[model samples]
Target: MTRTPETPLPSLKERRRLREAQSLSQADVAAAVGVTRATVRSWENGRTTPRGTTRDAYARLLTGAEEVTPHQENPAPALVGAATGPVQTSPDRAEPTPEPPSETSPASELAPTLEPALGPEPEPGPDAELEPLSPSLTPDQAFDALYAFCAPALVRQTYLLTGRRELARESVERAFQLAWHRWPEVAMDRDPAGWVRATAYEFALSPWHRLRPRHRNPEPPPAAPADRALLDVLLQLPPVYRRTLLLYDGVGLNLPETAAETEASTPAAANRLLHAREAVATRLPELAEPKELHRRLAEVASAERLRPAKPTTVRWGGEQRARHWTRAAIAFTVVLIGATTLTLRTAPDHYEPPLAPGATVHGVPPRVAPGPLSAEELALRAKLKGEIASGPERLVPEAG
Candidate 1:
């Protein structure tokens, strides 16, 4: 029988360690296990699991991995260019190899340079992975590199998501600012570009944008009819679906990464993607094909003159924002402490019940005689008393 959950298997991280330690890539594991490479990747990422027969195969491979001998300097296998030759993965960083598209997906049609827009990386020695942490580039220099590399494409992608040129620039700048604020974590992340990308996406799609007076109304449509129609159609989609489409079709992410970043189940992400495509296809049937859609998206994004701020400016803005928030927090803390101290110092040593509030006496007023009456009022009162004493019908002739 296949091992159940009760069976003590190595933790997921350990399993991955065992595989990588054996100088095997996910592709190699999938090849040996008779599964697709994505499946192997998902399993390692804790996205999915192995089934009965496959589980046994995986368990056997990794279980015996500990006993496997290593080459004097066994290098990790690189997945891309499999037929090229013996490729060694640099130990310093975990760069993902581009996977072949299985079908007509818009993201697949995008040139790798279109979305992340990274330059071709060199195959450095085993110590190359640690290069990011090396003293060669300071924080500012490294940040500038990442920003310069990613900002243009990321701004375009954000434009596709938000449909506003200015908002896109603002979002990308804010994301970079946040990255600078948390430079250590962002720099150490496996994919710093992705970190900034996710942040920009979140900022671009925030619902709070709707409340802003300037953003309360939709931005002007594109000058070209086709661009305008496409932009309108995209803006009509729900924020989540629109975001998913932008990430998958516009930004060229695979479904798994798209789902992970969007915080939705894979199936849910797929459904959103399908609905978004259908909506777009319904409006612009000519762009029904995935490749065409992707091309159109890139064109629309590029057509806009969404210029991002310089890296130095962005860094300075982030510094200022951080300082502002820091001072605000300190001021608030000081106010709170002062208020508490004042209360304690001036407060009575013991509890004193508050005086009962004065209440209106709901009773008749004490009888009192009037001081004086006006002459007119007095005559009118006397006349009224005479009529009461003698009825008008029984009045006698005036005899005295």
Candidate 2:
């Protein structure tokens, strides 16, 4: 029922005439067609065009074929009776039907001028086959779809970032775990693999890895001597330079994507990649050419393919999220309680002596309201009052 955008839609003038002939209100037509009244108005005013099932249903409704549902695949045009030509109206009619628009009629003047001829919409029949609602992708399906496509390359990229194979696998597994936990957002992205790769790359660099001395052991020797040499040289470079080389050359990302993954500007990423290549070329002169360097690095990087065991079922949409929120809320409350306890325990504890009958403690300031001014202030006020009453005469006499 979806019309190709290239197909010419029914003319606004023809649609208006047909709807008037049917004596249908715009609201009545919108309700029948499952669209807004404004949408129906847009169709008749030529402000916009309708496509898909909505358009087909609108055509059928206006032409008095309300029983005919639009085909799921391709739909045939609806035949509009007496509306394809001029409309006839009687003068005595409370709302006269409008004639077909002419060259003289402005688009703004187009309005519904018809009484309701079609009675209330008919209820669905018991035997009717209503349109099937599209099934939503389950979390397991979404996770599998992304995991199958991204895991191997993501593991390889992680290995390239960190020189250790086992560490690379661990980082990749962690990234996939997090991705599953937030699959809805991850699936909606343009490059789900890119997100995984970026995440795996960051995980490989986490400081927590330093605590595990076992990770320091060298992985099995590379199959090729050239690859071994390349891996050794890459490990010696700074992390930023190493990542830029792997993402740009080893993983085959473009300069911009490389920069984005590395959290650097495009120009800065390009500069780092250039330096990284030169740094590698210095250690191995045979890889001086850019193409040869990328080829060698890619060969070394692709040495391992990671395939983690598939989860039996990835708990998809909200259940996993709700549990996570619940845990987080619990942890937050525990921390708040612990902080309150610690603060109370560490606070200064002072003992105060009981106050005498008329004595006030400094720790608690007096709450008495303000009273009369001090003697010095009262004396000054009385002098000012006398001077004000004497006015200009007192001032002249004092000057004399």
Candidate 3:
């Protein structure tokens, strides 16, 4: 007759002590599988066996312990042996007999021995579902997507500045990488596509690129490459001015939206835009001809239209435009108020008491005399009257 050997079971306290002995705190285990420390404590207390994935982790954690596995099949036998005495088994049993418990039981023995092999595993809980990895896009894949959407304008801008196709490509590529890393944050922005283009230009002019020896060389300046001149002008402009221009003209973002993006005061953004427009007009006189500039700008803008259409779904259009109008109105009101205040402060005081009615002196408003009109006044009045009478037919007989 074949005989079966019984396994031993550890009490709740023993399980908790084993976990502590291995220097695996409850919180540490909980964090690995995305659960709370309380759950781990509950499992150790025998109040519960970790359900689902957590139970799986618990099983893996106790992998080396012979007693735990045997107990899984026959819980009563394991508990009896653990509670009462050494488990006795028939010689005919195929399974090896568990050694009598030493001062350190097998559970304790297993804890320290397995600690090195056990890694943090995901904890099972109501919320412990496996998360999918973020989808990856190859550099070329990203470039194709971005180029199709905004490449034309970015290219034109690059050519306008660097005059070199390769340099423009490099600048755009760097900007795309930055966008990819911050896709979540950038995607939510009002003009994410434009933001990417601006970021690329910024990356191109970053100190790292400027430090390149080729940039420092003062060779006869090459002829302005049609494609690179724009990029050059942008890089030459200060960051604030360049950003304002890009947000306004390049990204098609209005003033208030641009202000929010650049963290500028609305008036400051407007002033920057004005200054940028002047600079561009001065540098690229060709843009002064509205028809030609618009045509070129349209080509670039259309190219960006090819970008994935979904990113533009965040409708910031109405709200942002309204914000810009409101900001402009407020600015205008402030200026009006300031000008009025200044004029009031600087004006000369000219108010004087009105002259008494019918009073006169030399045909001007008369000042009050110390006494009423006397003989002197009468004599002076008569002389004035005589002069008037000598003039035009005796003053036209006093048109009374």
Candidate 4:
């Protein structure tokens, strides 16, 4: 019988830190595991957890015999791995993981074009051990802390993606609302902020974008050529490239972090970044350099910081409670009205009118016979009767 494997030793975050420590690219690990880089990332990010054989491989790769020892003199920890062990590398892959540079090393100043490691990294969950303070925080408290820290950055990045201030505000608010409703789960995530960011990203692209009227004039009157060129090129780039560029350079995330956010492999993200930069460089040679590109992107992101902070407007649970009360109140009122109407129609006591003094109510009035005529009227009647009896012969003789 096959022995049951032990549960994966390290958390997803631990595994990613291990990969970063090893300086192995994600493609390398993907090759060793016979799976895609995205699969490894999913395991790391808690999007879909690893199980069985996958978990086995994940544990082995992360918990390998290599250990990085810290030094007192040099602050940066050293990365150590078995020289003969399995390490993945593509034949045509030009970039290699650079050695750690010393504090004063020139290499430390340059941003190495490194691809992200294959494995996903975990962010600390809200319930995860936090420094100092209370032993336990309510879910609301945890969510509030997260919201306070992440809302501003989320708003700025969302605005970069949408280019509409109001829409970006709405997206961030709505995403936070979702986060609020799922507080328990969100509080347990490695990076709750990422969850909110991804949600906001989706909201930014919602079909509602089409229905809203454009706030900015499509064609502005007179602007610098470079500004016009940069805006046009940035907006015109494919969403993947545009978003990747913004996340990587504008938001100042490393390759691995950006890859995690985009759900793309480190290699794929690098490729997109390259193409996007090239596209911009081709259009606007003046800002073609990496430093210049980053400067421009940073400037754009910085401008958003001056905008007034908007508090998270979503309180999903509160809203839901209010709705429940309103619905119950309406139902109760309808029932009361129906019962009142039925009582008035069916109960005699309710329908009967009050009796008046000395009067009996009747369904119909009583009939009266004709009364006796007066004395003058009786004498006239007698004369008329006699005249009628002799009228025919007397009237005819007179005529003759």
Which sections of candidate 2 miss by over 4 Å? 1-136, 311-351, 354-400
The count of backbone overlaps in candidate 1 is 3
Could you tell me which 10 consecutive residues in candidate 1 have the lowest summed lDDT? 119-128
lDDT of 4: 0.59
Model 1 lDDT at residue 294: 76
lDDT of 2 by residue, 1-400 (tens): 9946643455777787777677665556766776544446556755456666666667677677774333322211111111223334333221113344444433112111111111112211111222222248676776776666566656666676787878877777777777877777877653566777788888898878878889666678677888888888888888999998776555545444455568775557756866887788899999865556656655665555545445443233335656888999999999999999999999878978776898755777676898989999999999888775755876665633
lDDT of 1 by residue, 1-400 (tens): 8846622457788988888778776656766766655567677777666656667678888877323343232233222222222323222212234344445434344322232221122112211122355558899999998887788888888887888888999999999999999999999775677789899999988889989999977788899999899999998999899998877666656555677789887657767877888899899999777667877887787678777889999999999999999999999999999999999999889888765789565676886977788999999998877864656755765665
Identify the leading candidate in terms of TM-score.
Answer: 1
Q: Which residue pairs clash in candidate 2?
A: none
Highest lDDT model number: 1
List the candidates' TM-scores in order: 0.69, 0.48, 0.32, 0.51
lDDT of each: 0.72, 0.61, 0.48, 0.59
Error of 4 at 55 (Å): 9.3
lDDT of 1 at 8: 43
